[model samples]
Target: MRLEQKYTALLGDVQRRAIGGGVPSAIGQLRLCFEALGLASAIDADCATRLGRHGLSEGKFVLLSLLRDVPEGLSPHALAERAGVTRGTITGLLDGLERDGFLARHADQVDRRKLLVRLSPKGEAAASTLVDEHAQWIASLFADFTPAEMQLLSALLEKAWRKTDRGAA
Candidate 1:
């Protein structure tokens, strides 16, 4: 079924089940619907499935994407901060990536205790290929949207992001 039809059905159900009389409560429920829809879209898009078929986890994909522009590599601490993860989580991601030969860790010249993580040539190529594919998928997914509609949606989402607990990106 079309997404709009699904949304309409769900909204009708929500309105029927709504307990409060005020418009504010109804608006709050609608906001929750938007959140649910966003999550459902993400999962249904199956970005993770595509990445997995390429032997890449979401964590690895994120790391590779971040490392693509930095030939010099980034430190674990920096990567963790940028990725909004803990150092331990970074270690886990690095371990898998290293085992897959997609990335390598080198001793920091200035600090022997520190390790600099960089993507291998294979990893770089993979990153480029995966990024292109993902972009194409996203473009196709939104093919029905007009340029103006996309711009407006982007602006609205950006506004919501700015208000989120994570703050602006």
Candidate 2:
């Protein structure tokens, strides 16, 4: 309700400015952007709550998920690339996950100077559970949407994404 009020107030301000021909076009775009932001925030909060139960942040969960099947493990560099994070960020994630006993790191067999990261048994189990639950949660959220509707929505989102993917404020 409060968010809706704010959205209406914003539209009112735009109209009051007498922006003329642009107002009609801007209204739809502005409304869509606001709704998208609200949805993103809601989804993020949901993910945080779910991850908190397992003592995992999104970053830690991503690492575990990546290593779930990688018995041989990956180097810190590889994980960083996979997760699209900096080396320092990857190191921190690995340190926290390792401390929690969710993953392990060891020197590479062929390259002793390099370390490889792998999931511990506990991490493997948690990853499986989390992935399954997350999938179910996402599906449930969209249960009311028909398949056709879902496709349309997805397509629209992709189109909208193209506009904001570069040089967007």
Candidate 3:
């Protein structure tokens, strides 16, 4: 069924089962949450498809994106922190990317004990293309919104995100 039909039917069910029209604005919020999940899933699929064309997974692409501008490269620990992953996870990702010729690791000049990650020429090209494509895809989604609508949407999303932040309470 269409998303609107699914939403309407769910809301109707809620109305039938509850008093006062289903939790006083919560149904609409629930609908928005569901819509957001759908959007996220679509974006994930799009990302996977695009990355698949290059034989890269999300982790590998993230490393590529991070390394694209860092000709000097980043330490494994720093890249892990920036990528919001653990040192072990970064190691695994680096292994695959290195094997795929997307990145290179070298001993740091300042700290010989530490290694830094840098992108290969092929990786740089892929990163540039993927970043551009991703930006265009994002723009297409918001192209229909008016400037005011975009501003309102941004503010609302910020507010909602702040409310759900770790220390919000």
Candidate 4:
């Protein structure tokens, strides 16, 4: 069977199981899941567009954000960990950012074998602007949620993320 057919079959099985149980509505749960997915996609698209306006992509944003918080800068391995990207990917990103006049790489004084990556003045200004823009965007997005609701949502999302992270590990 095709991928869609397999997915539908699995969903149908879950729906049947839910219906057989005391649960009132599996359709509502499915609808909520799809809605959340749609919201996530929209947010990702908006983020990509905003980052692109600054001549950066999501990966670059992650790298720049990490650098913004660290004055001394970070090594490729440290950047990879902070950005949740591969070491090779971090290297490429640092190279591209450096070429674009957004960052610089220097040999680590303590560890000569490792290269430390730091943002240039231009990069720092760009990152600061992006951070402000993102903060405003996030505030607008969550404007409808009350403080309690926001806290609950944050907790729930963190719990789900932890579960997924554990499963992946």
Candidate 5:
């Protein structure tokens, strides 16, 4: 069966199981969903807080992180792809970063039609500081997890992500 059909059947089974268990109401399921969303939002907020000190929002930080790995910088299209954001959004982000002296956009030397983005001196300094802080913050977040538990969690997350990507493809 197609993945969608399999997913739909799985969902139906879950609903049936829930109903058979004398679940109080749909509200319980809604609450669970909300709680999951809350956790995700909180994680994102924490990252944003850490990034904000270096004049970067979560999205901007993601973009800069992508750029940091490529000294020559990436074209806007490639940056958007790596950042998992829209072209327009990347454009606006680049504009904001440039205005704040974090990055600069210039025509590619070999291809004038393509714009290349690079971090300015100020931006590189900010990025280095933010990267260090982010590493510490991430380490703290998982401080409670044992090495085995962390490995297991990472594997599970990667598996789930691969499954999701396959379905999307």
Candidate 6:
């Protein structure tokens, strides 16, 4: 059975017992379902393992991912804000990536106080290879789903994520 099905079955039991026990409300139930999405479980583990083989930690992987999407790269503050991490955390991540020769930090042309980050050639190559491999791995996991289904799932998840993001802000 699928991971979600397992969680759903357990939720069914909870729903049945809601009358006797103070079970969660509708919103709470959705929270449970979201928890079951398990982004930190198999998905992170698999990506961590893969990145580990290249001497990259999960934190570094996340940093690299954010950088890869933008060729010009982000400032340290911007990176931290977008990654939902602290400036100190971004510093550490950048230090490691820089030490490993994956990225470079330089003064911003227009604003010297603000630093700019950019991927080195090595970083670009690594990001390209790793992203393709990760995409394939993710696609295989969701192979059972139709294109339409995947699109709907993506839309719903993005909506939920946006809501959560707004709440955080």
Q: For residues 42-142, what per-residue lDDT tens digits would candidate 4 score against the true structure?
A: 78999988888888988988888889868788888999997888979988898889989999998989988988888899989988888778889879999
Candidate 2 vs 6: which has more TM-score: 2
Top-scoring candidate (TM-score)? 2
lDDT of every predicted structure (CA atoms): 0.82, 0.86, 0.82, 0.81, 0.77, 0.80
| Ten contiguous residues with the weakest lDDT in model 3 | 1-10
Per-prediction CA RMSD (Å): 4.3, 3.0, 3.2, 5.5, 7.9, 5.2
Residue pairs clashing in model 1 are none
Question: 4 or 5, which is superior by TM-score?
Answer: 4
lDDT of 1 by residue, 1-169 (tens): 2345666676666666665543334746565656657666776559888898988887888899999889889999999999889989999999999999889999988989988999999999998888788779868877999999999988987776687788654
Per residue, candidate 5 scores C-alpha lDDT tens digits across 76-168 of: 899998888899999999999999998898899998998999988888877777766787887898899999999997887566557665745
State in Å the error of residue 59, model 6.
Answer: 2.7
Candidates' TM-scores? 0.72, 0.85, 0.80, 0.75, 0.70, 0.63
Q: What is the lDDT ranking, best to worst?
A: 2, 3, 1, 4, 6, 5
Error of 1 at 67 (Å): 1.2
lDDT score, candidate 4: 0.81
Clashes of each: 0, 0, 0, 0, 0, 0
Error of 3 at 87 (Å): 1.1
* Preferred candidate (TM-score higher): 3 or 6: 3
Q: Candidate 5, which ten residues in sequence have the lowest lDDT sum?
A: 1-10
Best candidate, lDDT-wise?
2
- Cα error, residue 151 of model 5, in Å, equals 3.8
Winner on lDDT between 1 and 4 is 1
